[model samples]
Target: MTAMHHLTTPDGIRLAYADTGGTGRPLLALHGAFGRGRPFLSLADRLGPDWRIVAPDQRGHGRSDRAADYGREAFLADTATLVERLDLAPCVLVGHSLGGLNAFQLAARRPDLVRAFVVVDMAAELPPHDSDWLDGLPETYGSLDALRTEIEARVSLGEPLHFLEGAVETDQGWRLRWHPDDMREVKRQVFGEHWADWYASDQPALVLRGGASPIVPDDIARRMLDRPNTRLATIDDGTHDFYLTHRTRFHDAVAEFLTTL
Candidate 1:
């Protein structure tokens, strides 16, 4: 079972997170864009009675408050506050896509806080995709069933969670979590060339790529492996949202990676 908690950042934004009970080293799990802490539920449970897993809903996603601005520095600062507030000793930070970017930036800024890191299905350089594609999602899914069908079809194609689409049930009916303008802004910040320079340190990091994912291509994966103590693992038939669609497999891979620590 997992328990929910709130951590108030220095700026007073309430961040929601889930903490699962366990004994050994603590691991912080960060979800990708369009994802919340809940999706990692199964994976945390599967890690068994050894590691304590903390998954947080980043600002502007899930139960967290949406601030006027959302950027990598803001997210990283919020995470740092969380780590200090919780008094969690050095931890293994697992980040997916957007989450992954935050983790790297945090480590680059404060290397002593993290013992190791795991990046899932993302690379320093993001693939070329039109911002118009994201702008079109609000009009794409008319109903929940349509959204579900779209998910299934794209899951069939091995697209991951961040790339699939976003829709949530609200009083206003099906709505998206982000504004198109924020989406474009955040996307550019994350995909820029500076992201690679941030990972220049010699830290132990694991980069997991979904076998059929386009987000993190083969060449990029190999480049990440070139980093200090970085290892690459590919889950066959997995997509961007590997944890949600292939929970057991994704969790198993994470567990295996932890075992090496």
Candidate 2:
């Protein structure tokens, strides 16, 4: 079962998170853009009783307070505070997309806090692409079904409907829990070159790639694998959100890796 909790950052923004309560080793799981902590629920379950999974809704996403600052420094500070405040130092860090970038940087800046790392479908050098869809997102939907339809239309081909996990029903109608403007700003900061951070830490790392993903190209994955003690695995039919789409394969890969550590 999952329990909800809140933590106030030094900046005073209240961040919401979900924890799979147990006495097992801590695993800090972070979601990507347009995603919240709840989607990790299945992965946490699959990890069994050995892992006490903690998934947080990063600032300006999910139930967390939307802050004015969407800079890279601000996001990193929030992760550091969460790790420090919760006494989760030396915990395993699992992140997807935007969260993956944050995880590697955190591991670089505060190596003492991260024991191991799992980065899904992200690379140091992200290819530039138009994000006009983010700016064109509708502010509100007439109903949940309407929102689902829109989300289904936008998601990549073959991705499950669960990718819309970030959507929530509000009194005003249905809408995304995160603000589009905030997401756009965060995206702006997320882009650009970041190879230094990716290669900074030699900590045991796993770079999971979706065979069909365009974000983390084959060459980048190969370079990441060149790091000592790091390994690369690809889910043949998986997309960017393969953890959700191919849970069993993803979990097995993670489980096998953890056993080696």
Give the top-scoring candidate (lDDT).
2
How does candidate 1 score on lDDT? 0.73
The TM-score, computed over Cα atoms with residue i paired to residue i, of candidate 1 is 0.85
Error of 2 at 41 (Å): 2.4
Q: Report lDDT (CA) for all predictions.
A: 0.73, 0.84
lDDT score for residue 252 of model 2: 86
Q: Compose the digit string of candidate 2's lDDT tens values, residues 1-261.
A: 577899998888999998887788888988887788787767666778888889999998888999999898898899988889888889988888889999999999999999998998888888566556665778789987888887777755335354467677778877787887887788888889898888899889989889998877888888788777898989988888888888899888888788878
Give me candidate 2's TM-score against the actual structure: 0.95
Please give the distance, in angstroms, between residue 63's alpha carbon in candidate 1 and its true position after superposition: 0.7
Q: Report the C-alpha displacement of residue 203, candidate 2, in angstroms.
A: 0.6
Off by over 4 Å in 1: 136-143, 146-168, 195-198
Off by over 4 Å in 2: 155-163
